[model samples]
Target: MGWCSCINLFPPSCQLSELKSTMYERQKKLFDSCQRASKVVAYRLKTPPYKLDALEPYMSQRTLELHWGGHHRQYLEYLNRALGKNDILYGCTIDELVKVTYNNGSPLPEFNNAAQ
Candidate 1:
């Protein structure tokens, strides 16, 4: 079998561990970007969502300030807190996590928390 085939053979916890490591690396980059930014915060938007202009005339600059700044930023900050430790995800790549978790059909719980 090919090297990758072994991935499919791994048990759930092993797979989850692999996914965790991969996701951690990938998330590290995003985390680094956040650290570089003045606010040190990154964003994650839920759907049924659009850019400020998508709402157009109804969503004026003031609306964006309230929605993106107040609402969106709040979500990101809260998500960061839910992720708990900084070093956990900062060391792996998202692709690696995805590959290992592939056998599990879904990501590990930490993946959901961190990606969000």
Candidate 2:
């Protein structure tokens, strides 16, 4: 039974039941935090903020296509692949993964590019 549902069983001035309800709320918060900490967070690439035509005059449309659509897309693909091989590194926040795999100053070879 959830904490809120238990409220329906008690009268307004019931002190003992109210105390139990408060304890239930505290336990629920701790339980929820533990559950959330175990969840896997997936990483993804951000789409280009501006359209390909937005950077005209100086940069051409082809440059934008190859840079954003090609190179950046491939980097994200590599990151996903690197994450798949390491269970400890899987689902880590980007900053956490980078620091964890950095190996003091030098990085592990396979993940060095993907991490940075």
Candidate 3:
């Protein structure tokens, strides 16, 4: 006899149907959770308070632009890409992400991007 046929409390058919129903409910819940987490948030890069050449005497316009627009912008892009909508870290604040990714002394792969 099959495993389901050995059950004495409920009919074999009823037990099998109940098991299938329970499995279906679990699958549905998982599917819904994934759908909710699929909405990725896009972070925008904030511009400097002053013009690119604001600190002309101390810092050159080209240098500031390269650092701010190039390097900083690139870091933000990497961070956003690393934290996708489906990622558990996606909705966390920068501070939270940094701490979580820090993993005590050993850092995770996304630690650098999150720290930046």
Q: Evaluated with lDDT, which candidate comes out highest? A: 3
Give the Å shift of residue 70 in candidate 1.
Answer: 1.5
lDDT of each: 0.52, 0.62, 0.69
Question: What's model 2's TM-score?
Answer: 0.57
Task: Give all candidate RMSDs, comma-separated.
Answer: 10.4, 17.2, 12.8
Kindly report which residue pairs in candidate 3 clash with one another: none
Model 3 C-alpha lDDT per residue in residues 39-60, reported as the tens digit of each score: 4366567888999988988999
Candidate 2, residue 51: Cα displacement in angstroms equals 1.0
Candidate 1's residue-wise lDDT over 1-116, tens digit each? 55543346666677777887876676555555442213323335545466656776866867876876787666556645644455433333444433433435566544553343
Per-residue error for 59 in candidate 1, Å, reads 1.7
Model 2: lDDT of residue 87: 51
State TM-scores per candidate.
0.33, 0.57, 0.60
lDDT of 3 at 83: 72
Q: Taking the tens digit of each residue's C-alpha lDDT, what string does model 2 give over 15-107?
A: 887876765565344334442344455556677788887889888889988887788777777777776775555655565556545656656
